[model samples]
Every structure is written in structure tokens, then in C-alpha cells.
Target chain A: MTEADHETVRSGLETHLPRLWRYGLSLSRNPSVAEELVQATCLRALERQSQFRTGTNLRAWLFTILSSIWKNQLRAEKVRTGGGFADPETELVFDGAASMETNNLLRRVLSEVSELPEAQRQAVILVYVEEFTYREAAHILEVPIGTIMSRLSAARGKLAGLDSSATNARKTRADEVGKN
Target chain B: MVSAGMADHPRDEDLVAYLDGELALADRQALDQALSDSADLRARLEVLRGGDRPFRESFDLLLDAAPLERMRAALPDPTISASVISTTQTPPIPANDWRSLGIAAMLLLAIGIGFAVGFGTRSDMGDTALLAELDALEAELEEAEAAADAAPVATVKGWRQAVADYQVLFTTDSLTPDQGGDGALALASSQVGLNLDPATRAAAGLEFRRAQVLAFNSKPLVQLAYLGDDGVPVAFCIIASNKPEAGTQYEQRNGLGIVHWIIGGYGLMVIGDLPEERLNSIARDLRKSIQL
Candidate 1:
């Protein structure tokens, strides 16, 4: 590959390192594995930059690669354990110092999010936390937009029970009314 | 208390999509009209919106907490394909081998280090490193073929590396369970003079597939093929050796975890795409079963 090609893809993927790690941590729930995912994803993006479409969202492309890598590891872990899947929850929790859940609400939200089944958690994080449009999140996850929407609604069905942020919503609405 | 229009009745998916602004324009406008017309609808939408947990700000904490420096240090230098590995990938070798085995030992160490450094800094987390190693490994195949000819003169590590290379070729479909492996295991076990009881075959917690007598350096090397429950391939091999007796040693080789040791003039190994600790435990179980 040309050096210019290397610099373009390398820098683009590098800029998203922390974000990729965050995504990886969400998937694997392990910090070391997240770092491994980032390094592997960078090498892969550089090696296969040819496949990346120019002018498309590079961050989405990189997240897709990171997601692919994480899924493959889970598959390998599946094979390694024979038929049973290893529980990521018990082994390496990403929630230790890496989590800054300072308030009760944030901590509860995180706990509720983390408690979702693997697939729903992924959909929620990509669409909500990372703000991938449902379309882009679907592409990264290789699921249809309908599936993403259903996963999110399913997540919202559970999370919407959190004591409403009604006070904040009311204040914002009052301010809007006053401005109008 | 006005009845909601059937055309505008929103499902939970619509409420979430509305929150995300992901609906098409016409659909969004319909939801907007429905919301403005009904206080109950607006209140329902507000609760869903309230469910937002500052997701971006919260995850950014995780992002900031990433060990960026360490991870950055580990990122491959895009300039050189093999530089980081050449300097960093050192196989675990005992320190005193230079004293006893001399240049032959050193030659073995050099070869181990040479190839290990070529692509071995760390095991491939998945296919990225696997694809790269596949290319590097083909280049080494000829060297392994040459070693096959000189097998009598080959050291344990040299031939084991060859065996490890052969392992990279396995897929989930590489072998089937119980394809005349009993016969081969019987014959090869007899040839190698080890009593691998049927119980020993199952000791590794894997499904037995087949066994074969493979020649290395013109010496018969017995290979026992097996698969895990999910079709993860694993192999237990025995090759005759004249090396001094050694305790079980565990390591990762060419992306596979291997636990090997010398006993009764044979080098025995349990190799698989498993973690080192796993292979080590399997080896321990086999050793215990056999010694009994």
C-alpha cells in the first residue's frame, strides 16, 4: 500500500482509539481485551484500507472492524470452551476504576444497561452512547434497522422506569415556554 | 380525552425512533402532530426521553480511563511490518541451556528466536494476526520440510515447531471424531512404547478423532487428533526423542497453546487453540493419568 494511504487510514483510526476501546470494553467487559482490540483493529485497518470506501464515515468503518474483532474473539472463546460460553461478567469486569459512576442515577442506569442481554446491550451502546444513527449502528452491527429499533425499545421498556428526569424536563419546558 | 387517530398511534419503537429523530420526515411530522394533540402522548414521549442517561458523557468516562499510553505503545508501528515483533517476541527458554547444549543448543535457540521474532510478539487476538502469520508461516514451511529430512538430527523444539506449524492448517472441519483413530492410536502407541489407555484419550476433555504415525527426521511421530465440543481442534502428539528427561513445560507457539514434556524417551505434547493455562491443565491431567 502507498505511504499516503497508510497515513490517511492510520491517523483516522488512531483518532478513534479511545472510542474503539470503549466499544470493545462494552463488548468484552475487559480492559486488557479492549486494548488488544484497538491494536488489532489499527493493524487491520492499515492492512486492508483498500476495502474502506473513501468519503464514508471512517469512525463507523473503524467501529465496524472493532466490533467484528470482538465477535470473533467471543466465537473463539466459544470454541475454546467447547460448547459452553465463558461468562465475561465473572472474569474481567470493565467496571472497576474505569467506570466513573459518581451518582446513584448514573450508576443505576449503567447497571441496567449492563444487565441487558449481549445483543441488546450492543444495540443500546451503539445507538445511545455512541450516537450512531440507527442506520449506521445497524450497518456496524450488521443488523437491520428494525432490529436496532426493537432492541432499543426493549432497552427503553426496561430503563424508562427510572424515576423520571421529570424535574429536568419540566425546567427545560418552562424555559422554552418563557423564551417563546 | 380525544380519541387518538389510528394512523398516528405510535408503538414503543416509534417513541424511541422519535426520540432519536430517526424517523422519516412524514413519519416524524405525524408523530409531532400526535404528540401536540395529546397530553398523555406527550407525557409518554417525555418519559422515554427522560430515560436518556447522558450515555455519551457516561461512556466518555470509560474512554478517558482507557490505558491509552500502554495501548499506544502496543499499537503496531505502521512503518515496518515486522519490527516490533523481531525485537519483542522472545519465547520462554530456560536460562541454563547454553551451558549444557552449547552451539547446537544455541543454534536451536537462534532458530526459535528468529522465527518467533518474525511474527510472535503476541498471539493473534483473532484473524488479523492469523492472516499475517499465514503468510509468514508459508515461507517457513520449506525450512520445516528440510527439517523433516534431517529429523534425526532435529532437536525437540525444532520438530515441535514443525508440528505446531502443521496445526495452523486445522479448521473446525479438519477432523471427525473417531475415524479409525482407535486403530492408529493403538499402532502408534505401540510404536512409541507408551500406554495411552482409552481413558487417557478422554482425559483431556476433548473428543477423540484419529491418530496417525507421522515421520519426522525419519522417526515415527505419533499424532492424536481430537476436537472440542464446539469443534475447536486439538491434538496430542508423541515423538521419540533421546533428549534428557524434562518436566512439563507450557507455552504458546505460532498462535496455539502447547504443553510438552519428555518422559521415557518420548516427547509428549498437548496442543490446541486454547489459552496456555488450559493446555497446561489438560497436559497435567494426561500426565497424571498416564503415570497412574
Candidate 2:
């Protein structure tokens, strides 16, 4: 693309960075990874600016780039190491929770959702949390609406099955030990 | 947690869609009525609702996830706001930035055009120097090429001896034909349509010491030489030949670098201890001053 076109697409992409970051966080579940993912998405969007129709949804276009990059990273990671999340403690490094109790609760929730399979977790985050319509989430994820619906349904089922009290008790005991 | 009582209850997808308001109006109305009648359906719906909170809370980090400024820095300056209320109205890049882009585009276009013209095809023979000069020049180049293979670059015979002798004459300020200062030197150079101007010498980090009109193979050659700021000798020779040429060829000897190229029907060669790039720059300057 010409530099002018690049600058234009860049400004267009700047408008979508926050949502892209959130979508990145949802996909990677790690702050640093999400940051890098958003950076890559912006770069890719700028590089391929010509592909973007000027008046189309820039947010959707950026999300599409982010989703594609994150998926490729996941695929490369999978090829390199057969796919896995980092240790949960590493993820905790960026928790920035308001209090110990909230931290525990947030971590519990995070762990539960993170443990869900990728498709289900993404479906839940994009639809329920991000509040995208099923169709919009489908477009972002590049899946059919039926796939989005079922994934969301399955995610809810898994999340509902987690015992919050048991998770809290576990965190409480771990905290007590740390204190000792 | 819906007790195994209600059949034909909305499937989980349908219920999730209902919660999402993704259900069609008629389907949503039917589920709303059925929900009021069946406690089990309400409980089932409640369980689905419970999952929504954690999912929302899990991603809520995003709500507070301030954009990392470094993310925006990847773009050009004057940051574009992430809240660009509408993408269609993307701010135009400033005009000067556009002008810079235009200049860069033109530069690349010029380079491409130059490459195509320089190497793409032979300029017609008529566009070259007369045939006899072409033959003589090619023969001289061929002989120099064969001699260069057997000798170190600085010690190449024929022209090397002439350049070395000229270097000595130039270093000792003993040039004949033109032995005066700036005015006389400029007069001599202008007479031959070339300049032995000190500004050019200064640009090449040398001080002009003398200019001479000499001959090689009965062809008039203008020899201009200088002493570098460090006292090493540098020299340039402009030859008036009827030789056609392709482009410049570079030869480096011991420490001296030589560049030879033809302008119109005259050949110009610069011999120096400077880098080949420096020699080429001087050659380009001289080429710029000459017209076919």
C-alpha cells in the first residue's frame, strides 16, 4: 500500500485498538500476549490496508485480523509444543486485582473459563461478556451462527458445572499456607 | 439443573439465544410465556444466567485494560485515537506527509526508470560515439583488463605509470600547460569545457594543487590532481576521446581507486586513494557538468 493509504488505514485501525485488545485478551488469556497480538493485528491491518473497503466496519476488520493472527500463533505454538497454556501462576502476574478476596474470586473465574476448550471459551467471551450478537460473534470468529450458538451453549454448561465454593476454599487454603 | 420433567422445553441453544434476545419475536414470546408457567424452565434459565456473570467478569479486565501506549506508537506520529467514532472519517494524513510520500514514490520510480534505461537495452549505436573511437576504446579497455589480471590494481602498467608520474608532478606543484592559481586553472578547465574547481576538490576532501593538459595516444587529456588534507595525492583525468561507452567501470590498485566512464565522445577517469564510492561521486559530478 502507498504510505498515504497506510496512514489512513492506521488511523482507521487506531479506532479499534481497545476492542481489539479485549478480543486479544479473550483469545490469549494473557496480558502480554494480548498486547503483542493487538500490535500484530494493527501492523497486519496497516500492511493489508488495500484489502479493506474504505467504508466497511473497521472494528470488524481489525477483529478479523486479530483473530487470524491469534489463531496462527496458536497453530505455531501447537506445532512447536503440541499446544498448552502457560502455568496459571504466570497468568496471575498480570492480575492487578483490587483485593485479595477479589483476586481469588477473579482468578477462580478466569481459571474456569480458561480451562474450557478454545471454541467454547471464545464463544462465551464474545457473546456473553463482550456482548456481541451471535451473528456478529460468528463473523468475528469466522464461524457459522449455529457454531457460535452451540459453542456458547456448551461453554455455559461447563462454567455452570464449576463449584465456586470448592474453588474458593482451595484458594483460601493456599493463601493461608502462603501467610504461614 | 432443570428437573427431568418438561419435554419440548426450549433446547439449551434456544434458551441461550433467548437470553441473548437472539430469538425471533414469536419464539421469544412463546419462551417468555412458558417460562412463567414452568419453575423448571426458570431454574434452567437461571443456571444459564449464572454462567453469564463469570464470563463477563472474566473479560471485565478488558474494561479496565488501558491501551498500552506502545501499541499506538507502532503507527506514525500524531496518534490516531482508538475511539475514532467512525472509521469512514479517518483523518487525512497531513499534506506535508503526503508530499513526502509523493517524493519517495518519485525517487523509487526514477531509480526504476534509470535501471531500465541503463541496463534494459543497448542505446542505438548512433547514440554512441563514432565507430573508430568505440573500437580503440574497447581495445584499450581489453588490454587493461588483461594487464589487470596479471598485476595488482594499483600497479597496473600503461595508465598506472602515467597516473603515477602525474601524481608526482601534481604533488610537487610542477605541472606544465597550467601552473597558475584558481583563475588560470578555471580558465584552462573552462577552455576544455570541464572545471578543475577547488570546490569539487574540497568536496572530495582534497586541495587542488595543479591542472595540466597532457596527451595519451594523441588524445588530449586534462589532468587535475590534489593533495588530500592528509598530504596523500589524488588526481582526476578527463580524456577527450571519440569513444562510445557503456557506463563506469571501477578498478582499485594497491590503495588508489580508478573510475572510468565516457561522456559524449570524451572519456573521463578519476584516480584516487579514496574509496570507490568517493571516486564515483566525483565522476557523477563531472558527468553532471558535461552534456552530449
Candidate 3:
């Protein structure tokens, strides 16, 4: 890349770092990994500056690069080693009497969303958190629009279930408090 | 697939698309009518949108999370590049002029003196040097004692420095196979007692990425990169220890969290941009899975 090109890429990377990190966190579910993904994405963007069309969307381009790296690494990992399955539905289920009167319900809901299955979590994060259009999310994730829709649907249903359970828990707690 | 209960109603995917405004004009009109006619559909739609509020809120933390200063620092300096380009574009400098040479020498001497003074006295030239050094030494000793109390171990500050250096190397082309030669699992096995097995790493919710031999503080360490389920990068580092003792320590440097422990004669470190608690949990899992 030319000297001016390097400067341009540097400015672009800085501007997008925070959003890329958020996307990374949403996709990977780990802060460290999110940081790495952002770093890698920055490096890739600089390395392949020629490939980046000037008139196109830089944010979407970066997200696509980040998603590609994550998926490639994930695929390589799956090939070398397979992990034991942890049941997300069981792990994230709320107890009937657990408190739902959290001051930061948004954070609570987000945490619950993070605990979702990886595909569903990414779908929800891109659609709801980042406010990406379905087509944009589908393009970034390298999945069909139908897949994105299905993932979002499943994610929505899961969240609704969790919310109702939490609501019921709050009610049960109130009822017991009233009885005593 | 539509659920048995929702057989007569529209599919959940259709409802989600309607909520997202992804439906076409005609489809949106039909869904709007369905929503107006059916209370059940509206209630379900509201529940589905409930997550949208909190889901968006969770992401605010990511924005508020500290900026990636280290990554930015690793980028190429445009000022230096601009200077390089300018020099190449310009004619060669004339044979060094004595006047300019003399001025450059004086500037160098002044900067050298400034650095020496800064290092030696830290701008403090009082008789309290002994007390300051003593205080610093005492603090260091106290920290050592506390670490000893928690677990019998010698401090390996090199591991932390290595992690810092690795973070720098990771962003550059030097990190690619052409430069550092990506050391395989077999190579890693020869350096230390541990294996970069996926099954072992998976116990800690990490997936192995690559392993390489990197030098830090004049010592070669086997550094294995892993991706946690959420895509956080975790480094599993091992170096030969002078003291074959088993103890664990936690430290945070340059916004990255490190959990280093000794097992057998090998010093192992788990480093990442994670919290201390999270690092400890991964370390605990590693300790269990690695079998020393």
C-alpha cells in the first residue's frame, strides 16, 4: 500500500474499532476474543486495502472480514478438536422463584441473549444490537437470508420464554412475601 | 417449522420479519391485518420484541469498554512513512555540512544527558534517594511475601512481558508463518510437558488456533493461541522454569489479564483480555485437564 493508503486505513480502523469490538463480543462471547478479532480485522483490512472498494460501506466490509476470520478459525478448531456440548437451554433456564427485578433489565436481557446458542446469539446481536438489516447480517454471516430469519425467530422465541419465566418468578416471590 | 399450537397462526419467522419490517409491502399489510384481528398474534409479537430492548442495552457495555489502544499503537506510523516517502522523492542530501553536524551532535548530547538524568533520579535529586529505593524495594518484597502466602512460587515477570510482546507481534506480518514459522503441536510437545490438544483446551471453553515458539527475555516459550467459544483469544504459554514448583499468580498488564502458574518444571501462563476471575477459571480448568 502507498503511504497515503496506510494513513487512510489507519484512520478507518480507528473509527471502526469500537463497533468491530462490539460485534466481536457479540459473536464470540469473550472480551479477549473480541479484541483479537478486532485486531485481526484491522490487520486484514490494512493488508488487503486494495481489495476494499472505495465507494462501498467500510463498516460492513470490516464486519464481513471479522466474521470470515472468526468462522475460518472456528472451522479450523472444529477440525483439530471437537468440544463437549453444553446444553444452553438447561444452563440458561431461570428458576421459578428467582428475582427478575434487576435494576438493569437491559443488561440482564443481553446477558441472557449472550447465553444463547452461538448462531442464534449472533443473529440476535446483529439484528437487534447492531441494527443490521437482515440482508447485511446475512451477507456478513455468509448465511442465507432464510437462515438468518430462522435464527432470529428461534432467538426471539427463546427470549420470550426466558422473560415469562422471569416474570413468573417475580410474581411467585411477591405472592410469598404477601402471604408472610 | 410452525409449532403445533401455532398451526393456524403465522410462522414465528413471519412474525419476526413483520416486527423487523423486513416484509414486503403486501406481506406487511397482511401481517398488520392479522395483528389487528388476532390478540394472540400481537401478544406474541410483543414478547418477541421484548428481547430487542435488553439485547440492545447489553451492547452499550461494549461501546463503553476500553478502546483498543494497543492495537492502534501497532499500526504503521504515517508520519514515519511520510518522511520515508519524502526522502525517496527528494534529491540526496549534500555532503553533511559542519554547521548542521555540530547542531545535531549537540542535540544528541543534550537528549542523552536528559535520558540519563531521568533514569537515574526520575527528576528527583534529593538526599531521599535511599528512602525512595528502600520504599520501592519494601513494596516489592511485600508483594512477593503475599504471593508466597497464597502459593509458594517464584515470580516470572518474563511471562507477562512475553504476553505484552506477543500482543504486538500478533498484529504484524511478522506473526505469519513466513516470519515466526508456525510451530505445530509436535514442536510444542517437545518444548514442554503439555500438549496443545483440543480436548484439553475445550475443557476451558477454548479452541486451539496455532502454536509458535516465541522468545521473551532471552527465553523460548511455547505459545499456543486458542479461541474461546465467543471468539476471545486465549494464549496458553509454557516456558522452562528454573524452579520446578507449582503455584498460581494473577496479574493485569496493558489491559490484558494474565494467570500464570507453575506445574512440574514448566511455567504455564493463560493470558487474554479477560477478567481476573475468568482467567482463574480457565487456569483452574487447564490445571485439571493438563495433568501437570
Residue range B1-292, candidate 2, lDDT tens digits: 1212113446666677887789777677777887988897798788877766555675565456535564563343422221111112234432112222222222212211111011112334432333333234335544654665565344323444455433432222122112235243554466356655643444456566655444343334466656554655566677566667759989765456788877676677777666778778877765665554
Order of models, best TM-score first: 1, 3, 2
lDDT of each: 0.61, 0.55, 0.57
Q: What DockQ does each listed candidate score?
A: 0.20, 0.14, 0.19
lDDT tens digits by residue: candidate 3, A12-32: 878888888777756644444
Scanning candidate 3 chain B in windows of ten residues, the lowest lDDT window is B111-120
**Of the pair 2 and 3, which is ahead by lDDT?**
3
- TM-scores, chain A, per candidate: 0.74, 0.69, 0.71
Candidate 1 contains a number of clashing pairs equal to 1
Over 4 Å off in model 2, which ranges? A1-8, A78-85, A88-108, A162-180, B1-9, B54-58, B62-67, B77-292
User: For residues B52-159, what per-residue lDDT tens digits would candidate 3 score against the true structure?
Assistant: 555565566546553467445434344322211121121232221112222222221221111111111223343244334433534554464466568644454455
Q: Tell me how candidate 2 scores on lDDT.
A: 0.55
C-alpha RMSD of candidate 1: 15.5
Name the best candidate (by DockQ): 1
Q: Estimate each model's TM-score.
A: 0.50, 0.47, 0.47
Q: Model 2 has how many clashing residue pairs?
A: 3
